[model samples]
Target: MQELQNVVSTAFANIVASGAIEKAVEEKLQKTITDAIDSELRSYSDFGKIIGERIKQSLQINFDTLGLPGYNELILKIVSQQLEANMSSALTEHIQERMAELLAPAPSAIELSALVTEFIKLETERAGHTPTSDEFTLIVKRDTSIRSMRFEYVYLDPDAYKSEYQCKYQIRIVDGVVSNVTFNEVDPSKKLFIGRLYGFERRLFQLYAAGTELILDDETKEISTYYPHCD
Candidate 1:
């Protein structure tokens, strides 16, 4: 019974020894793995820095070989040129349009004799008098400062076989509107005779006072007496 007890004790001691050896090996392996991981971690920052520098140098070399500006400079130059081109095109177009408008021809003036004849007819009719053919001449003068016009009419002979007469009229224009008109007979001595021959003075004043547009040609002494006319 003693021998059986000793054998059992030896078996237990062997089992303990084996277990201790396995624990020691496991601890050594864990320490070695931790050290290796730490070393790799410590080198990661330097590896990243070396790679970054190499990439930077390679980019710089490529830019120099291609004779190209830096990215930032290139982008700025492109943007500036684009803006300048657009502005120049727009300005040129604007100037061209303005020059075209300025170079266009002005409207032609109305014929003189035709306007005077029409005016005489309308005025005499309004005054309840039959229009008669009378020889007359018109002299036009322009005032640029006041934007006004003056007209002088000399009648060759009275239709009623009376003395000759002269009439003058002044028209003031403001902002394309006929603001005021003045009429006078030059020969007051022949007033009664002029009145009897053509009662057109009062009618002329009325026609202009009622918002009539008068287009006159200073160069040719002609006037436009019709509506739907241009200045």
Candidate 2:
């Protein structure tokens, strides 16, 4: 009887082990779960991409409709060019009006300019030559025009010297064109003065040619700077 019981128990164990009643294996179940999770995670990734694209579209539409500040540099440059092109004539007129307003000196300033002009002319005539910097004691003490803008005018008479300032310049401008520039500073010794006069005349002619607008370069930059105009 003991042997039969052992035999039956052994047979039952063998059958169970041989997969007559199979159950899910741990490794296979784990693998299935992992695959499902991976699929779900991939879908989530796609969903995130969709959300990002939607956000981008929404922002672009808002920017266009509300005129918000996207492409700010490009927009500003294009608009400036358009404005300048379309309103060239009107812009010139507008600029001229503004310049007139801004450049309109006070009554006192105008009076001072007139007096200085008269004084210089009278002094030159009285002295029979342009006055030296030291001789215009009152003007020298009061204003720096003589020192600052001396290059704009003929050379000063130094210690009653006449020949040094004798060279004369004749410049004619019509319709903003330098039709003629005549000067007697032909001697090699006076070439430096001629060069200076050339620069001055170039500026004067360019200012007239530009007419309410300016072309920026090394030569014309000072026109934009704040300089004390003796005139």
Candidate achieving the largest lDDT: 1
- Model 1 Cα lDDT, one tens digit per residue, 62-148: 545777688999999999999998899897997777545433442233233444665545454554443243333344444455435
Write the residue-wise lDDT of candidate 2 on 1-231 in tens digits: 999999999998998898765544666788899987676556357765677677788877544677555698779989999998999999799778755643344221112233234434544444355433333311111223555331122222222334423523332333223334344443322343233323223333333333322111233212211112332
| Clash pairs (backbone) in predicted model 2 | none
Report the lDDT of model 2 for residue 198. Answer: 31
User: Candidate 1 at 26: error in angstroms?
Assistant: 99
- How much is the lDDT of residue 22 in candidate 2? 57
